[model samples]
Target: MNDHTYKITAQDNILFVDASGPFDFDTMLQYKSETLEAIEKLKHEPWGCIACFHGSGVFSPEAEEELVLLTRERMRKNMAALATVIQDSRQADIQQMQLSRVYESCNTKYHIFSDVKAAKTWLANYLKKQPN
Candidate 1:
C-alpha cells in the first residue's frame, strides 16, 4: 500500500480515516493496522472515529469482513462513537445498513453522513457526551 491509498489522523481523541478510491485488500489491511496502532498508541482511551469512504473502489468480501471484525473489537474497547461518510444514494444506504448490523450486538453508537464535515461534527459531539 502506498501513501496515496489512505490517511489516518487523530484530533481531539477522534480517529480520522480517509480512504482513497480503488480500495483493495491490501489497502484495507493497511488501514486496519494503522487504526489499531493509533488506538494502542493512545492507550485505548475512549475515542470517536470518522471514516470517509468517498470514491472507494470495489473491495473483497473477506476484506470487508475482517474490517468489520476489527472495528467491532475496538467498539468492545474504548470506541465511543463512529461516523461514516459516503455517497448519498441507495447503494450507500444499503452499505450503511449492512455496517449497522456489524454493531447490532455491541453498544457502539454510529451514524451515517453524506459529507465529512457533518461526520466530524457528529463525532466531536458524540465524544463530548461520553463519560470521561
Candidate 2:
C-alpha cells in the first residue's frame, strides 16, 4: 500500500475513510479526489461519512484546513452527518476538537469517537433519522 494514499469505502449510504500514513497537502488532495469520486459513484441517495484515523500520522495545519474545506464540499453534495475515529491521544483529542470547532457553524451533525464501531454506529443511527 502506498504510504501517501488513504483508503475509502462505501457501505450502503455510509462513506468510510481510513487515514494511513502522515497526511500532508498532497496526500489530502489525493484523498479528496478519491473520496469525492467514491461518493459520486457509490451514493444511491443521501449519505454520511465515517473517518477513521487509527493509522494516520500527524496532520499539518494546511492539511487540516483542507479537511475542513473537503467537509464543506461534501456538505454541498448531500452529506448528512460525519463521525471520526482517532487514536486515544492528547494530540488527537486536541486536533479533533479543533476540527469540531470548524464545523460548529456549518449546521452539520458531527461527532468524534475513539472506537471505530462506535463511530459507525453513530453514523447508522444518524442515517436512520433522515427522510427516505
Candidate 3:
C-alpha cells in the first residue's frame, strides 16, 4: 500500500479507517484488505463498521465504479462469514443516492447512520450480546 494510502487505528472497539485519496479502485481494495485483516480484531463478534466518508461528499466516476466492485468483493467474502457493515452517513442527497446501491451490492443487509456514536453503541451492544 502507498504511504499516503490510508490509516487503520483502533479506538477501543472502533477501527477507524481514514483514507487520503479518492475512493478509487486501488484505495477501496486496500480498504477491503484492511477490513479482512481486521476481522481477527472482531473478537466481539458480529463485526460492524463505522466508515466515515471524508472531504467532498461526492464520489468521482472512478470511485463510483470502484464502490460497486468493492461492494461485490466484500459480499463474496462475507458469504463465507458473518458481518454487519454500517457507514457513517454523508449529505441527505448523497446518502439517498448511495443507500440503495449499498443494499443492492451487499449480501446481507447493512445499515447507514449519520450518528457515529449511535452506530458504535449499537455495534457494541449487538456484539456484546452475541454468543461466543
Candidate 4:
C-alpha cells in the first residue's frame, strides 16, 4: 500500500506541490515520474518549485537516494530553484538535512522554509533574477 500522497500543479513557471509522506522507493519513483511530466508542461523557460510537505516528511534511505537523482534530473530540465515548506520544525530539520545533501550533490539551488508565503515570495524573486 502507498503511504505517500502528493498533488502537483503548475501555474506560469512555478510548480506547486503539496505532499505528505513517510515515503518508500516506489512512491518516490512515482513522484519523480509525475513531477517530470508537470515540468514538461511548463513554458519553455526556466521554472521554480515550491513544495509544501506535511505529516512526518520522512523517506526511506532508498527513497532518499532516488531523490538525489531526481534533483539532478530536475536541474537538467531547467528547474532554476526549489523552495520547501515544512511546518514542523523537527521534520523541517530532518528534511533540510536530507535535501541539502541531495541539492548540494546535484549543484541545485534550494531553500527550506516554515511558511508557504515566504517560500513563494523567495521563489518568485529567485526566478526573476535568473537569466531569461
> Which regions of candidate 1 deviate over 4 angstroms?
1-4, 88-91, 105-107
TM-scores, all models, native as reference: 0.79, 0.84, 0.57, 0.93
Judge candidate 2 against the unseen true structure and give its global Cα lDDT, from 0 to 1: 0.77
Better of 1 and 3 by lDDT: 1
Whichever of 1 and 4 has more TM-score, that candidate is 4
lDDT tens readout by residue for model 4, 32-94:
999988898764789999989987878889999999888888888889999989875457678
Tens-digit lDDT track of model 1 for 4-94: 3678888768878876545456767777888888877543578988877755433466666767777787776688888988763445655
How far off is residue 43 in model 3, in Å? 7.6
- Per-candidate clashes come to 0, 0, 0, 0
Deviation in angstroms for 102 in model 2?
3.3
- In angstroms, give how far residue 66 of model 2 lies from its true place: 1.3
* Better model by TM-score: candidate 1 vs candidate 2: 2
Candidate lDDT scores, in order, read: 0.71, 0.77, 0.51, 0.87
Q: Write the per-residue lDDT of candidate 2 for residues 53-81, one digit (tens) a residue.
A: 75445666787778778878888888999
Question: Where does candidate 1 clash, by residue pair?
Answer: none
Ranking according to TM-score, highest score first = 4, 2, 1, 3
